[model samples]
Each structure stands twice: as C-alpha cells, then as structure tokens.
Target: MLTLRDYDNSDIEALLALANNKLVSRFLVYTFPYPYTRADAEWWISAGVKAEGDVTKVIEYNGQFAGSVGIARKTGWRDHLAEIGYWLGEPYWGNGIATQAVQQMTDYAFSDLKLQKLYALILAPNTVSMRVVEKCEYELEGVLKREVFKDGQYYDVHRFAKVLKI
Candidate 1:
C-alpha cells in the first residue's frame, strides 16, 4: 500500500537516501540537488515541503518512505493553475507507484485544493514521466523548444495539463 503525508524530522535520513541517487535526479529539475546533502534535505523540509498554498507529500510505500509528489500553486497570471512534480527512488520504479501517486495527488489537487487545472513539464527524453502524466488524463498542451539547459545541453520541455470538470 502507498500513502502520501507531510514531511517530518524523522524523514530526513530516508529523504536523503532516496533523493541522493543520480538516476532519481537525472530527470528532475535542478532544484532537486543531485548530491543531495543533509543541509539540502533540511532546507527543503523547512522551505519547500509545506508552502502556504501548495501540496507537498512524501510517497510512503508499505509504511516506508519511497518518494515525493506535489502540486505547486501558481500565481499572478496563472492563479488557477498548479504545477505538479514527483520522483521516486530507483528501487521503486516500474511498480505502478508513480502512476498511483500521481492519480492520488491529482485528485487532491482538484478536489481538496480546489484548483482549476494542473500541469507538469517533462523534459523531452523522459518519456516515462510523460506517460505518467498521460495515465492521469493530462493532455499535452505544447512543447517549449530548448527551454531548459541541463547536463551541459539544452532540452525541449513538453507541457501537459488537465483541467477540472467544474
């Protein structure tokens, strides 16, 4: 069974362990530091985990911490939209975990958060993540060509979004 919950002090070690892997960080944005350190985890917990309007959750698998997912509330011109992002440990990959977590979070974002729409930006090479969003009924809105520079190269970002029924 998988569950999503708030971050706590006890989650530090598990967070560090799962987040420190290069494979897990490869498709993630630059903000998710590759060499994931204790300081990084601490700062994330304090600053990123529980933002005022956003929903950030730890993915707990069978009672153990495995990954994280969240819906970031947008502002200014995009107040009705929320950006979603998630990552799981390498060990938990390909077991339907990402799909399940994404579905659950999407529901929360729409129903509990009362957001109008949710979006996810996927780097071109990460087809698995693209599929993850697709599985949750998000539609491909467009592609931003060479929008992000990472690993000494530029990559296209595929924008996917889903809107609430009403």
Candidate 2:
C-alpha cells in the first residue's frame, strides 16, 4: 500500500539515502542539491516542508519512505494555479508508484486546495516523468527550448497542465 503523509524525524535517514543520488537529482531543479546531505534532509523536514503556501508530503510505500510529492501554489495573478512535482527512489521505479502519487496529489490540489489548475515542468530528457504526468491527464502545454541550464548544459522543458472541471 502507498500513502502520503507529513515528513517526520524518522524519515531523515531514508530521505538522505534516497535523495543522495545523481540519477535522482539529475532531472530535478538545481535547488534539490545533488549531494543531498543530512543537513539538507534535516532542513527539509524541519523547515522546507513547512514553506509558506506549499503542500509537501512523504510518499510511503508499505510503511517505508519511498519518495516525495508536492504542489507549489503560484502567486499574484496566477494564484489559481499550482505546479506539481514528485520524485521516487530508484528502487521504487517501474511500479506505478509515481503515477498513483501524482494522481492523488492532483486530486488534492484541485479539491482541498481549490486550485483551478496544476502543471508540471519536466526536463526534456525525463521521459519517465512526462509519462507520469500524462497518465494523470495533464495535457502538453508547450516546450521551452533551452529553458533550463543544468549540469553545465542547456535542456528543454516540457510544460504540462490539467485544469479543474469546475
């Protein structure tokens, strides 16, 4: 069984272990730090998870910390929208865990958060994530060429979104 819940102190070790991987951080934003250290995990659980206006949850599979999923509300004129993001441990891949988690987070963003739209900006090479959002019913919005500069190289970004029915 998979579940989403708030992060706790116990997750620090698992989080550090799973997050400290080049394969995992390669596709994520630069802020996600490649060498995800204990301090980073500590700060994430103690403060980052509680960032104002954002909702983050730990993805637990069979009672073990498997990954993380979250939504960040857009500000100002775009307050009606939010950007969804998620990542799973390499060991947890290919099991439909990310797809299920994205579906759950999408529902939560629309219903509980009352957001009208949720979107994802996927690195062009991250086809697995593109498939995940697509499976969740997010439509391809557009592609921004050379939009992201990561790992000393420029990569395209694919924007995908799903709007609330009303």
> In model 1, what are the clashing residue pairs, if there are any?
none
Instruction: Please provide, for model 1 over 1-166, each residue's C-alpha lDDT reduced to its tens digit, 9 standing for 90 to 100.
Output: 9999989989999999999999999878999988999999999988878787788999999999999999889888888889999999988999999989999999998887788999999999999999999999999999999999998899999999999986
Candidate 2 regions off by >4 Å?
none
TM-score of each predicted structure versus truth: 0.96, 0.98
Local accuracy of candidate 2 as per-residue lDDT tens digits, 1-166 = 9999999999999999999999999999888998999999999999998988999999999999999999989899999999999999999999999999999999998889999999999999999999999999999999999999998999999999999996
lDDT of each: 0.92, 0.95
Q: Provide the lowest-lDDT 10-residue window in model 1.
A: 46-55
Query: Which residue window of length 10 is worst by lDDT in model 2?
Result: 29-38
RMSD of each: 1.0, 0.6
Any idea what lDDT model 1 has?
Answer: 0.92
